[model samples]
Target: MASRMDRAQAVVAIGELFREHGYHGTSYGQITAATGLGKGSLYNHFPNGKEDMTRAVLAHVHGWFEDNVFGVLASKTDPMEAVDQMFVQVDDYFRSGRRLCLLGAFSLYDVRTAFDAEIVSYFSRWVETLAGCLKRGGLSAKESKVQAMACMVDIQGGLLMAHAFDDAAIFTSSLARSAKTLRAAMGDRVPA
Candidate 1:
């Protein structure tokens, strides 16, 4: 048994564990080791065990994206600049393909059914926010949504390919192509 840590620290430790090993693959022993906390302390912090811990972790991730990613996309001043900022934020957040996407990883596994609502809301909110920005940029509702979904697909799919290839350039190229396509869709002059 080790000393107990603060709840926030424990949540972050547990999140990294979960990110490395999917929900089913992660175990109490690993979490305890990662947090340097005993089983009893973990129980005290997360009464329902991993479920409660995961919910807390998800909430934390969601809050971060809401503030950093979604907030900019929702900004009213300049939607195109917001879209451009999104690429920068996403690249920085993912560490240029050196990091795994926790939400995307979960969605690939069976546990996706367990956390359906959280996962769905995460993707949905991003797409809707981006679509709204495109709409304000003069795109019709249908086309904006189509392009928004395409952009997400490129990002997530690029992540998969980059992870498989062990190459950050793949992800960077994917983002560049997607951004170019978006500019074309918006009838803006695509910078060479």
Candidate 2:
């Protein structure tokens, strides 16, 4: 008999599968194969099955993003630098040859009903964190929130365009344009 797997390892494996194949596109069998766990063993950890596993994956991704991306972005005092670094972080993230965004991929899947609340709450917190950063950079609360939403849309769209075109340049250019626009909006108040 195989040794039992830990919850963290299972969650990480599920996240990798979800990242590669999306929620609906991935199967329980595939997850088991990927994790080297039997069905019963899988269920032992996630009794609710795929939905439960997916929820765990979403939470895992959320926490990872919060700590790595948002945490780093929020650390800098210069709002403009923070915004620029955000793009740099995103560029490095996608340039690492990972074509799919875990959250973006999950949103595309039919398993929407399975993780709706978790996904919504995750995105809401992301937006609020970004908007808060922009507000600190001298933008009005309303402006920051709207701009943050626009930035998120641009990122999603840019990723799609980059993948469709089979080019990273498009993604880089899109981010650069966004940074320029944001800097222009901030005017003299933008960090030196």
Candidate 3:
């Protein structure tokens, strides 16, 4: 088995490339090159090759969201502060929208079938967690769910727009609007 650091580094490198080129677009050679590891070393880490590497990358990405984004949303704290932290984590994950999302890219292709269950669970978990936060902030359960769905849509669409327009501000503004919506739901306002 590879060292823990080696595995972590490999997963991160794979995620970096996959977030841009996507699963099918990313080649084994590219993965090795990104990790500065030889083909044999990569194969040793991922004996099943690219698919195994992608699975590890997906888990790594999911774990990051679970810890950073979902954890903030689930925290019992000032709602707005939690909302801000969630967006901050989102921004960091996408490199302020300069990068594509690994899962988002996968969604555009038929290849998602291979990892459908895991991918769906990631998104569902995010929506449910955010809905819980919205509920705590005074939205009715139904309303909170609706808002959570909208937020997810906004995030996915906003990231696409940001990448296409080459403007990180597009995503930043979307997050601001989503946050404003949430704050308004809580009967609060961002001071002018």
Candidate 2 backbone collisions, by pair = none
- Residue by residue across 55-164, what tens digits does model 3's lDDT show? 89889889989999988899846666777788888888787778787787787787789888778988999999898887877778899899999999888888999999
Estimated TM-score per prediction? 0.92, 0.84, 0.91
The best candidate by TM-score is 1
Our model 2 lands, by Cα RMSD against the true structure, at: 2.8
- lDDT (C-alpha, whole model) for all candidates: 0.85, 0.76, 0.82
- Order the numbered candidates by TM-score, best leading: 1, 3, 2
> TM-score of model 3 relative to the true fold?
0.91
Q: How far is candidate 3 from the true structure (C-alpha RMSD, Å)?
A: 3.7
- Residue runs of model 1 more than 4 Å from their true location after superposition: 1-4, 189-192
- Could you tell me how far off, in angstroms, the CA of residue 10 lies in candidate 1 after the best superposition? 1.9
Cα displacement (Å) at residue 145, model 2: 1.6
In model 1, what is the error at residue 178, expressed in angstroms?
1.2
Compute the lDDT for candidate 1: 0.85
State the lDDT at 147 in candidate 1: 96
CA lDDT, candidate 2, residue 134: 82
